[model samples]
Target chain A: MSSFFLFVLTTLTVLMLVYLYRVVRGPTAFDRVLGLNGISTKAIVLLVVIGTTFDRVDMFVDISTGYALLNLVGALAIAKFLEERGEERQ
Target chain B: MTFEFPLLVLLIMTAAGAIVVKDLISAVFILGSYSFALALVWALLGAVDVAFVEAVVGAGLATVFFLLTLFRMAEKDTQIRRPPVPWIAFVALPLLAILLLYGAGDLPAFGDPLSPASTHISPEYLENSVEQTRTPNTVTAVLMDYRALDTLVETIVIFTAGIACALILRRGT
Candidate 1:
């Protein structure tokens, strides 16, 4: 069971690396933001998967909850900033 | 341990990407990704509390603050200038890397049971922390009770730094 969790964790990490490639090579800032969001969403799951591996699901769940909230707030803030910038240009 | 290598690679890649990216917004986003990688590394190392702090402050708040500062700047200024490569960095970087590697050699291996930290004081704290502090988490008990003053001071330092940043970045009244 633990090994299965570890496998999932490794797979997620690999997927995150793929997203990171998008972040690095993406042509537009929006593409980079999308990649970042994907990475962050994966990280939240990674945290919970780590907790399960440690046999401390409750603790990690709390951290992941906070992480999710912050991730959403950060995405919203960036979106607002981009929107304002677009309005200024127009 | 097997997953650690890939996460560390991710960390290094994000850090390098952040530095090499020309667009300030892209760099900021890459920095946020760097923070996520670091937090994952901390979680892998079994430091969930540290990972939580890294995820919150490093990834969340710092990225937003960076974007806010970038938004305040002119579009032209947001494009980073390609500075000439510094000759000094060539000499200094290798020297610094060598010094750090030499210093690292003196430290105990990761998770060594007989390491100074694990051998001394840690056992007692691990045993009695819950009884003394009534906190289920030993790390929390140690930080909040055994070393309460230190944590308080650290909080004050962070608060002061936040104030300083706001003062420096404030616009005209």
Candidate 2:
């Protein structure tokens, strides 16, 4: 079971590399923001997996819940900034 | 160990890309990705408490702060340029990297039972944490109970940072 979780973790890390490509060569800020969002979502899952592996799912779940909220805050903040930036440009 | 090496490399790559990217917004987003990768690495290292903190502050608050800074700066100021390669940076960076790598070689292997950290205070903390603090999570117990003063001081420092940022950002033409 741990090995299966470890496999999932490895797969997620590889997916992060794909997201990294989007961040590095993104054509626009929006693309980078989306990539960041994807990475954060994956990280939340990874946190859960880590907790399960350690047999501390309840504790890790609390952390991940906070993480999800913060992720939302970060994404909203960036979106707001870009919206303001666009207004300024116009 | 097998998991750690690749994650570390990814962290380095994302951090480097964050600095190297041309656009400020893209750089900020990439920096978030870098933080996320680092949090994963910390979780894998069996430091879930640190990992949680990193996820919140590194991936969350720090990215927002970076974006806010970018937005506040004038448009021209945000255009990060690839400056003429500084001779000092070139020479210094490689030396620093080599020094760090050499240092890593001397550190105890990952999760080694005889490592200094595992053999020292860790056992005492683990064995007595529940009895002392009645908290299942020793990390929390240590921070909030055993070392409450330290946590208080850190909270004050973070409060100060928030105030400083607000003051600086509020000052304007």
Candidate 3:
């Protein structure tokens, strides 16, 4: 891997650590959920980057598609759960 | 090295955060993030199939299950107090980590062709998969042909889990 790409990956990872801080210390459930959603979206991009590094974009792209689909579903489910839980508390 | 090291650190941090978080809902969300990080690390290591499974199972299905269980618990129970410092865990876990790290130093370097994992049946599977199973992907061939029974059992296990979850949740409803 070139130094440029390595630098990019390092920067992105540091960005993810920032997101991790939000996840760990977010004051509200929604903030934590949004943090997780952001991280998963980044994961899809990271998968593509790793695919290019391995020179097997075709195979890894398929996996990333699946990952993205599932992440969307999981996020929606969590949002619905949170909405319902809020109503119950009221 | 650039790819795996940062990801491994993130993975461990998220896992520990998930455990330490006071709220079950926040912990579940962090756990999903942890799974996403773990999947990336697996992809970086070239284990695309395992990475795929981790993405779907860990980030997807497992998170849903955790949220469902969290909702089932009473709201009061969800607000758990901070656990006391685990003295035994602090001692045993570090000792285990050191021992594992010491052992890992003796293992072959990453992607070493002569490593036991790469040298044994894997090479033969890679060489013969296409011709023997008529499958283009060696991973597909190994899962479907070389270890069909194992795959079948895994499918059955997942099916049973779904059934069990349905049964339990149905009763509560």
Colliding residue pairs in candidate 1: none
Better of 1 and 3 by DockQ: 3
Model 3 misplaced stretches (Cα beyond 4 Å): B86-88
TM-score of the second chain in each model? 0.88, 0.84, 0.89
- Residues B1-173 of candidate 1 have per-residue lDDT tens digits of 47787788888989998889888888999999999999889777767778888998999989999998898888999988998999999999999999999999999998899999999999999999989999887777888899999999999999999898888878532
Pairs that collide in candidate 3 are: none
Candidate lDDT values, in order: 0.89, 0.83, 0.85
Candidate 3, A1-90: lDDT as tens digits: 467677777777878888889988999888888888778777888777777777799988998899888988998998998899899989
Q: Give the Å shift of residue B71 in candidate 1.
A: 0.8
Task: Compare candidates 1 and 2 on TM-score and give the better one.
Answer: 1
- Give the TM-score comparing model 3 with the true structure, all chains together: 0.92
- The segments of candidate 1 whose C-alpha lies over 4 angstroms from its true place after superposition are B163-173
The root-mean-square deviation over C-alpha atoms between each candidate and the true structure, in angstroms, is 2.0, 2.3, 1.8
